[model samples]
Target: MSTRRYPHSSVSPEEFHKWLSTLICVLNSVYFVLNMITLQKLGLGTMQLAVATFAGFCLYKSSNGFYRPWHSYALLISLTINILLSIAVMDLVAGATYWGLALPFWYYSLFGLRKGFIFSAIIVLSAAMVIFFRTDTQVFMPYRTIFNFTLVYCSIWLVCHIYEVQRQKTSEFLHSLALQDDLTNLKNRHALKADFQAFQHSFESMHMLIIDIDHFKNINDKYGHDIGDSVLIKVADALMQSIHTKEIYRLGGEEFVILFKNINDKEAFRQAEKVRKAVELGIFFSHNEPIKLTVSIGISSLRPEHEFTDFLRAADQKLYQAKREGRNRVCA
Candidate 1:
């Protein structure tokens, strides 16, 4: 196997984002209480009910699956409508403009730039509409609030864009890591295992061929360790060249396993013979000399009741038989 590292599989980042939603919900509850203290200041009924209802929705989202990015956007829409309806038309024309700034932080961290920006625009425009219609308060309200809101919005937009770009790079890096063989840059045993799973349900009618190079240790001893490494690379190239979308696996040292998904018994036998002949036809030329190479192959049909390991063991036994009988041939 090639020496590249493949990270083990794990849960997706989206699956772990629920805690963020819950934290936001708790914050909403706190904000709701503070807003309620302004009840006599604003009036008794409408604005207070509107804020409390939104807090209740946040709590519901926390307890349910509503914390996802799409749901957060939907909740923002609902809150916008509620705000329009509850605030006195004259009071809305005044200077209470905050729901816009607050809602984006709830969802933006979890999404990419285009989507996060769109969501922010939606909330901001919704607030602007209410603020446009509401207060004429000259006390706390000024044209600078619009400028400040826009500044904060642009800052958040840049941060989210950078974050998404980094995440995408990391995902691609992980994908490349998965396909690499840890020792040689060849495909590893894990790749073969994944292809096998693809076939178990869809292509139950297929064959397995397992190949092991003959007298490899003798070469390692005859040549130096560096030469031995070169021989392994040449052998891996030969196998890869001969196989057809067949998964090539380095099972350590001189043993390699190739699996061709969705081929019948006779076709599989033909394919195995082709590989055996291609590998054994000549020597692997490295440096100025030709180093003769031959591989022994064991072929087996996958039966309905046989587990993957069982089939592999059967193929392995045939491989040993080929070595015992004389190498450079295939056996079933």
Candidate 2:
């Protein structure tokens, strides 16, 4: 299988799900053989065999690069059913009942917070009901068994819930760090590529605008790097204020990118002009000294066969043309 890491973590959810399912498959397969051959429990063994087969099939498909989200649900649901069936057949003393405790962690890891909590609750309540009603009170005190089981289950559930919460918070923070510009607080180049892939198929036509601060090196030379940073921040603010629908991205240094959707070339040029005038007229201050700034914008329309880089290259070429003609003009 591929070993691609997610932006937030070393292992992607698909990889985790594959490994978890593989483990379950092996365990269930071993249990099935044991039950069928040694324990002489045909019904439970058959159920285990079925769950193992399903898990194995999912693994095979995943290895072949045919993974799907429903495959995860199917495997988890089948395993849960098999566990419940085993509990019902052998009762609480069979040792399968303890597996319910681990289900919370698995569910939380696979389904995430909301669905994980839901599935965990279902399994916990279902297993509790089976233990409460099925236990022999004379041999094993039903109340004590239920009480201890519930207490431990709840403790594990709480821990899993807290861990999942923290995991989600960390994942979001890392994702933001990966995709956001630290200085301007705008989306970065990686975010631009990601967003392009997300929305490329949704819109019929798209346009890109590459905006560059005119003579930005001169600004840093005359003032300072700190003042240049201040200028970039102010320019980002102006871009945010000027555009309503499109998202603005800082593509490192003094360059920014904006994506426009469902607009013609003329409209895209008009929007770029609007942004240019906004930056030109705005007053930027660094250490209480007002600095005048102008931005050159390049506009490019998405072509049928264009990839993200090609689209970006087209706009970048136009940006160079804008800089060649004049510093404060817009080119398409």
Candidate 3:
């Protein structure tokens, strides 16, 4: 078993799934043992034991982020096994069919909306078929049993559906908060780092530009912070309009970063110049007076031996050079 910790917190869905898988393994093992000892139903018992062992191994591997490629399919397979077992044991065990009731919750949590609903339907239908066809099972009020089962299963499905919808909304809200800048509505530095780190190994070549506004402090000092904010907003708008790609980040204050994917050094420098010119040409008005704004940009392309920090530092150095040489220009 691998001991490596995956990139998921204790509260994350992956961690929750891991714990759930572990629980399933233990519970299934116990059920299998009990069925084997008392009922001696060799087929059901053996199948349950097999499922238990599979769940256990998958849990171990997935928790440590090892061999996780089959994890999703494993979930579906485990649920199918349990559903079959539940139907098969309905006649032998008292209230065995009730075991299928929890299927909705697990499906929704593990597979998400569409697949969850589908699995839930399959479980419900399988249980119903067993009840309808296997009339040899000793039970009273057959119509009432069918009615109540259908109603209860439908209720469970509806509840799980609503819960998953809300969970998805909350997840999306949190994800946006983590990645988006509150002021400019652009992605923030945290988002930039996360994205770059995840995709750095995959991208063969890329370009980065660090942009800074010229004498931004003077604008804040001369016109007040309100006007300074307006300047930043306008500048952000200009940059957004100039770039065709979504890999733009607001690095706080007056600094912004743009990442160009699969672009060479010459093309990167050309894009930086184009953005600088766009910002210079953009017109902004403050207190009925037109203000001309310009930005200095430093461009750097990924090198064969560059780490993320090295690439960023190269861009920063070039930005400094641009500022020193003269504002309103691009440096490489």
Cα lDDT tens digits for candidate 1, 1-332 = 23333322133323434444354445444544655564434342344455446545655765675555465455445555544444434254433344445545444554444666677777666555555454557663535555676677567656765666675678556665676565567666666666666676777576778888888888888776788888888778877788776467876688888777777778877888888887778577556777888889998788888777887888889998998998988898
Candidate 2 residue-wise lDDT, 209-326, digit = tens: 9999999998899899999999999999999999896468999899999999898988998999999999999998877788999999888898888899999999999999999997
Candidate order by TM-score, decreasing, is 2, 3, 1
How should the candidates be ordered by lDDT, best one leading? 2, 3, 1
The clash numbers for all candidates, in the given order, read 19, 0, 0
Candidate 3 residue lDDT tens string, 1-332: 11112322215556667777787788778878878898787777787788778888878887778746357467657656675666655463467767677888877876777878888888788777766665654665556676788889889999998888887777666677778887788888878787677667778888899999998898889888999888888888889898798888899999999999888888898899889999889887789888888899999888878878898999999999999997889999
| Window of ten residues with lowest summed lDDT in model 1 | 4-13
RMSD of 2: 3.3
lDDT of predicted model 3? 0.79
Report the number of the highest-lDDT candidate.
2
Model 1 C-alpha lDDT versus the unseen true structure: 0.64
lDDT of 1 at 57: 64
